[model samples]
Target: MELLEGNESRCQNMFWMNKDVFIRLCDELENIYKVKGSQRISVAEKLGMFLYTLGEGAGNRNVQERFQHFGKTVSRYFSGMLNVVCDMTKEFIKPSDPKFKSIPPEILGDYRYMPHFKDCIGAIDGVHVRATISPSNQVPYIGRKGIPTHNIMAVCNFDMQFTFACAGWEGTAHDTRIFQSAIHNLALKFPKPPNEYPQMKWYLGPYKCQRYHLPEFRRGAQPTGYKEIFNHAHSSIRSVIERTFGV
Candidate 1:
């Protein structure tokens, strides 16, 4: 760091911050975060290496050698670093709840959304995530796809942004069940309490409730207006989730 500050640093060694930042961060872990364990290399070193891997995914041995350490598997480093990073970063990266607002009659013309999708609050759908189960269960766990594992329930909006995701549900679970689960598990910070997830806040503008309401979605024959409306909204939101993983 001192050499770099003096303007004598070379391009090859300019990544000195990677080391310095790592050390300082490790100091944070030890002093501020209070991780009480003896380690040869500081938490900073492992962290720097982890950040570097994010830029360029590498094999375990490859990363270990770059860190100037030995016998540390990439698996161990990934497990530790990600566990901490996810815990620290999820609140910031994930999307907040949805809301219900009115839409402008001018924008909708006769239908909704001038010509595009109008009054469409959002779309919601569920997905399947394959898991690696044991021998016997693997066969059944593989839904219609004939693969392995179960399904993950995910939801999104008409604009194609994903608002929520619920993984690890069995494939046999219903879409409404997945919708209910997503709402129940949703963080309450962005939403008002009375209803689980935030309702659309506007009837016009961006807040108009434009749900995807697929025809096949409400299969059980509940036949209620609100249930149908919610199912449609969930369906629309779910369409986005489907397209997301498709990429």
Candidate 2:
């Protein structure tokens, strides 16, 4: 209760989100998703406990101590909260413009990308997230990172909000493998723009085997030819996904 009623910074430090956002999230979970507070604990406390575990990487015992609940109570609420949040993904993580009718404000306002990248809706990339698995099942999950990880493929808009995410591929799985699976699976509802703009692709990528990253072009030789120039711009726009993951 103290954390919930405390100052903004305290709430953010503990929950990784502002107090108002946390309250709004709880309200959404209750009103929209039909998540109810248990007889002993409120929804806010349940969410706080879950977020605390994620933010601090705390174990069940740590959660029990912090929330002053029994180990079983902590574990139960944590699992419940996780399931509820997962259910919220389809509602929350989707494109602002599903039809891709309007040009993104980021592309429209910036002259560098205005005319060229107006068709680009978002960027896609994969990131490696560490996974916890049994020792017997660890080999398939170990890849170039040399750790048990899941390759999470995500698409983000220019504003850096995730529009779609597909997870569960092992670390050794290729990005193309995950992407193919996502697009092929009708249930995943992978975002595919309308075919009105047949002249250009809905998504763009830098030229393969070319200098693509911004930093490389920055320190070394400047982009010269048309392909290099185009790659630079493509890389610049695509960097939003990298920044989103970085945050």
Candidate 3:
């Protein structure tokens, strides 16, 4: 707590946000989740500790020692805060208006893309987030990387901001399979395409994507012709998702 209050840079580094934003986020969490301050630890302290653990990706035992709290207490506050944040996700993350008028001209003006991606809203991809689970449930979560993880599917617009995110799929699950499930369950409502371009409602992605696919270059051979152009443009646009994940 004292460290968080020390300096702006220290606060940001510890909590992954400025002090003002952290306080505001806590207030928002309290408004919806209602965490009352107890004699042992105040709500602010609990939130701070949880955020520190999350930002640093530290283990429960490490956080327990850092905050001078028991391991169970640290884990409890962390889980509570995580649940509250998950519940509030829908309220905070949402797509822009379906009209598609808000798209910037930069995406529309690039010659490599231009008409090919004029209607593209963004890109979608899957990322693996490490997870810890009981032995009985660990089999399903072990990913191709040979680690227990959850395959998180997310969509981001050209501005590099996430418009949608879904988790809980086993890391062993294929990205296409997870995407198919999301579509079948109607869990995501993608923006509607313009009336004149009804067929352009989908976003661009790599060849492995089920909804969109770029031409594949043959083994030991370079791509040529329109396939090359299309793949280049598609890669340029789809880099947004990579940048978002990196951040």
What lDDT would each prediction earn against the true structure?
0.52, 0.89, 0.75
Candidate 1 — which residues are off by over 4 angstroms?
1-73, 92-119, 134-140, 170-174, 185-239
lDDT of 1 by residue, 133-183 (tens): 668766556667777745665444444555545566666666666655555
For residues 1-247, could you state the per-residue lDDT of candidate 2 as single tens digits? 7877878799999999998899999999899888888688998988999999989878889888988999999988899889988889988899988998889899999999979888888999999998887799999999999999999999999999999999888999999889878877789998877773534345566788889889999999989998999999998999999999998
- What are the TM-scores, per candidate, against the unseen true structure? 0.45, 0.89, 0.80
Which prediction has more favorable TM-score, 2 or 3?
2
Tell me which residue pairs clash in candidate 2: none
> Candidate 3 on 1-247: residue-level lDDT in tens?
6765688898898888998898887787677678777899888888888888878878888888888999889988888878878877776566665576765566866776777777787788889999877789999999788989999999887877788787888889998887766655555654334663433235444444222223433333454555555675676688788899999
Local lDDT at 122 for model 3: 70
Instruction: Locate the minimum summed-lDDT window of 10 residues in model 1.
Output: 202-211
- Angstrom error of the Cα, residue 34, model 3: value is 4.0
Worst 10 residues of 2 by lDDT: 196-205
Could you arrange the candidates by TM-score from highest to lowest? Answer: 2, 3, 1
lDDT over C-alpha atoms for residue 149 of model 2: 97
Count of backbone collisions within predicted model 1: 40
lDDT of 1 at 40: 63
